[model samples]
Target: MLAGPAWPHSTPPDHGPDMTLDRIAQDLFSALRFYSRLPTPAPADAAELWAAPDMDRIAYAIPLAGAVMGLLGGAVLVLAAWAGLPEFLCATLAFTILVLASGAMHEDGLADTADGWGGGRDAEHRLMIMRDSRLGTFGVTALILSLLLRIGAVMALMAAFSPIQAAFALVAACAASRATGILMLRALPSARKDGASATFGQPSHKAALSCALMAAFIAALLLVPLFGLAAAVSGLALCIAVIYMMAGISRRMLGGQTGDVAGATQQISEIAFLLAVLILA
Candidate 1:
């Protein structure tokens, strides 16, 4: 293994070596492993990347990974459409594939955050509710609404545009949403002293900006060509607005953020993006 710095930190590992193609690939793999259910890079590559001093600096790679995921899931919708599946069926299947692909990671977060925020009277109670495995009324309601909204948005986008446009919308929304959620790490403190998110710690402002920029580029490319520059800009603006609102709610309610809050933020941002696409497309 290309050992150097410790597991997680803000700066790149202090190894005397320059950033190479190998390092980039490893960083991408780290992000995929951390964010998705997809198979990660080989163990050797993963170990090397994990050892990089500034592995946390690879935060920018997360949205790139999200784009890749969207591409894969979007392909499902495109293919299903071409196969003559009904728009509703295609949208449902495509959404299901997406949920499976991500192991429903973000959805899980959304459910937990909903249950906690809805049921808890205080921080301790909320955090305790969030950590519980059992689903409650709030969680079930959130999950149902989220699923129905996303699937309905997909169907609506398909109705408004070609299957290709729908696919692009999914990719743009998925990538941009995941990118926006990272804002919490830069904007707020950690709610818990230790947990999944706490393990990686916070990111630098510059690194966070880099991640947002990458996602913005991808989102614009996917959105503008189909709808126009106005659509892309407006859609992303709404996404940013939603992320900020979610961050404020999480900060005020929980005093900071946890992995669940971050995940829920992504879910909400995605819905916001799709709503914009539906309005503009």
Candidate 2:
């Protein structure tokens, strides 16, 4: 099972005040540690490995981390297709790598959110349900549907175009979806006084904006080559809409954001982005 989001009990490296290249690189490393199960090199001060990520500082680097993560999956997709695998199998293989690499961290979050929302009678009950490690029927169903939709969409993309094109689409979706999670984190208050989301803390407006801009720029660059400029813009707009709607649901249903809510935001927005591109293509 994917471990829960790691809100480590450590501190940031003293990279000084300026946003130096070293600082940015460190933040990207922090983001990878928090967001994925990839074997990133540990910091020289190993204690920082167990420290809570400075979301405000590292949040802007998340999309960059996501782009790196997605590129790995994309490479697998390309290689599998080159080896003459069917589109369905190629997409599935690539997606499997992505899930394994990330330790299904976001998938776990999506399941928890679905269970909490579907099973709870109120905010407190929902939060309690989310805290339970066991998956409910609702959670299981959500996971199945999410996985199916994502895999099928990738297959469709590959069938319609070359694997290279589909791989870039996946990269764009991954970057934009994770960036939307930052928006959800910024939009809602912490649902509880404790836990990962609360301890990880909200990103500042500047950090959130930086993340959004970078993600959008990256998505546009990759997507425009495959889809027209208009389609690229439309896909991004649809993704933002997904974030807006999810944020509203999170606020009303849970009274705030949890780690699960943020995870669910990423999973769903990724689906929306992929479908938007496919439909517009």
Candidate 3:
């Protein structure tokens, strides 16, 4: 954009925000702004970030934002358990908190993705359908199935493990799956010429790798203790596999990724990880 050499893959070059005493912390806050309803950096702190690169690199921190979300939900589960609520009720309240925190952004994506891909006969038709705000048959079905699977898996994990263990597992699943969204963003071009996903730009390989390692570390720390090394490995693999499959589908059907596709990928990866936990935990 500065009239220099072009980036490969047509992705916009990574533009760094002004470095600060708390650059990473600020990036994390920017990520929260993008991914959830949580409060972020104050106006003063946010001003510089908005000036240069915008939030192009914030994708690297999405998993951290998701980890925060998951930990908050886990806290809710623990509090509900302490209050003597039934396991199912505790699980319900925890996930409900998460859905509220994220504004169900990723869930909305999955539904729209399903409708677009399922109802359209061609890529153009599918992209147009996806751009619509209204829900349809496929969207409704996808939402119902995704919600049931996610909630059911959480309840089962609660039943199968201690509150702390279950909470850790949930946190790990969330962190790992959300990273898939970032990875997907980096791997594909935007299907549309311009939108949130396209404008966000592609993360560098190093940034993507850092996000992946952070996700893997979080998963390994929490899951290996409860489900053993083998299961933990498999579960993380499952989440990544879901990302790969979803990315493949997005590429085939829509030509590239979009904000909605990234969101849908998060939902699918979250469910896949949870299902893996249900089976192996």
Candidate 4:
């Protein structure tokens, strides 16, 4: 359907257009990498700011944005805990912040992927099922279960460990979950001809590996100083195991990867990270 990947790679012309920095910033925001040093303009009322040249760079940006947002959400949780907020409330607030920041993009992907895989009998059928916009029973169930598990795991960790540890766990889970998406994108072929995933799914392996390392380092920074280096090592091992499982599943189900599969990886990886933290912390 993509006609041998003939998508144009030319940079947009710089002449005669009255594009505002807001437009560029919106594009970068969607791309999700390289935060702008320029001042963000006054808020606009429309979503037009999100339009940008969809490409591999933007695909690459998604995880970076996810990692940053994960860190921010983690920071919020830590601050709330430090301020004496209840563990349940802190966990809820941190999860809510992540959902708000990412517009639930990964969650939607997870639901769609679950519906597709659970309902379909074959690779072609799975791909078609995932393309549908409507959520099936499996999708709904997967979404509920994943969210509940994540929240519950974080809450349990908070109860068992210090609030700071819980906060670090949240941050690590966020980053590791997104790193799963990057890993899958790097390892698998796109399942569709045209879609957001297709547009941003073809990032180089080197880029993905770099992002993964950065995420691991960030997680380590958050965990090692607080719980000792063993905690960080355990977290990294868990993240790697989760990614490996997702990779196998992706290959078996669709012969490669779909946008929904990538989403599923993120969701599953996040859950895995939280579970690991709960067990190891």
Candidate 5:
């Protein structure tokens, strides 16, 4: 008879505060690998890591990764602009880096959401369309348009402001986008029985809310210097409004939020924040 699945085993644990952070860090690292389609380290190596449910880990990981992306993207923008790179080319490169780093996970969700919302006639049909992995015409168009708009905004900001301002704009976009995802998770019920969102969405609302506020604060701090405190406030209000509107639409069409919907929220919010900064600055 075939042997039962051999689960790897571990011995003696540290159980200290540092160990807890290390566990959280390992979980976040695993999530990044999963989202980015990078190879996962062996369980033996990750044995000290505590299990974080999918939705909870995703909720935590998305924003943390966003912050990292923002820093990297800002560095890219500053360096390219200093190198006398064309604004359009610099923006394009920055966008490319963001996509590559996140593995286009949220962008794919945005496209899927667009296809569902545009092509489906009813809630059931919309959910079905979203569940289907095949890319539709509407999805293709939405992806292209989103990228074009993002590129335009980035290029315009670079042309209008100093490299420091451009860098802050990138950071604002990244933080605000992931903040949108957290807000949706806090507000919407999970739409599917078995999915990442369903697993990760079980975290207490307090935790979700705390993370959301932290993200918003990070974005606001980045924007205030470039756009002034009042402008930053206005920009944050715009971001929240856009995310709430998208959440309502997703609830109506999908019957609730799914991973794709969460991803869609992030992408839309990012664009909204970028536009707000561009207009206000």
Candidate 6:
């Protein structure tokens, strides 16, 4: 496994002589490994890549990874809809594909964050609660609500628009939500010394900006054509609002950002984006 966080603080080992296409390809693979359960062939330096993922490079590729994942899940949604499946069942199946694709990493983060934020006495206590793997009442409730809300949002989108249009919305939401989540690395300090956020190292402003711009491009390319500029703009605004709200909550409760906070941000922003599409479509 990736040993203690030595490389995150230093020059990453994966850097090559230059930013060639090969390097960009490697970074994309690394991003996929970091963000999802998708099977990827190990590069020659897989050990070093896993040890200290160069978030600076990987950040740029995260939106693309999310877009790929969205396409996979959205394909299921489109096919099910075309097969005359119930909209609710199609939505649930699509959501299940997404959860399985990512191994529910974001969901786990959401649960831990809610439990810690809702039940802890202090920042330290909250961190402790988050570190515990056991599910709590707060976590259970948050997990259920998150799943239900997203599925419902998908159902609404299908009702309001065609499944193909809703699938594009899913792709845009996935890209945008992940882009929003990566900004936390720039927005707040790491909450714990050895936590995942800290171990992964803070992404520089340029990296975060690149991620955001790429996602915005993806959103515009996918969403604007379907829902119009106004709806797209509104969805983006709500995504930014989610980032700010999550940042404030994380700063107040955990004293900074963590993996869980990022996950929660993505989940909430996704719901916000889908709802915006449903309302406007």
TM-score computed on alpha carbons, candidate 1: 0.90
* Candidate closer to the true structure by lDDT (higher is better), 1 or 5: 1
Compute the lDDT of residue 281 as modeled in candidate 6: 60
Error of 4 at 76 (Å): 4.6
Residues 114-176 of candidate 4: C-alpha lDDT, one tens digit per residue: 888899999889888888889999999998998889888887877888766777777767766
Per-residue lDDT value at 130 in model 5: 88
List runs of model 6 lying over 4 Å from the truth.
1-20
Pairs in clash, predicted candidate 2 = 8-51, 8-52, 10-51
lDDT (Cα, tens digit) per residue for candidate 5, span 1-281: 21111112223223345326766666556655654544445555464344543444345555565766777777888889889998888888888888888889999898889999999999888888988999999999989988998888888887788777887888878876776776776667777777767876544554465457767777777888667776567667876776668767877777677888878878877887788888877
Off by over 4 Å in 5: 1-31, 34-61
lDDT values for all models? 0.81, 0.86, 0.81, 0.69, 0.73, 0.85
Model 6: colliding residue pairs: none
Indicate the residue-level lDDT of 199 in model 1.
69
Residue 195, model 2: Cα distance from true site in angstroms = 0.9
Model 3 TM-score on a 0 to 1 scale: 0.88
* Weakest ten-residue segment in model 4 by summed lDDT: 1-10
State the displacement of the C-alpha of residue 23, model 6, in Å, after optimal TM-score superposition: 3.3
Checking candidate 5 for backbone clashes, the offending pairs are 54-200, 55-199, 55-200, 56-200
The most accurate candidate by TM-score is 2
Clashing pairs in 1: 11-54, 12-54, 13-53, 13-54
Candidates sorted by lDDT, best first: 2, 6, 1, 3, 5, 4
TM-score of every model versus the real structure: 0.90, 0.92, 0.88, 0.77, 0.82, 0.92
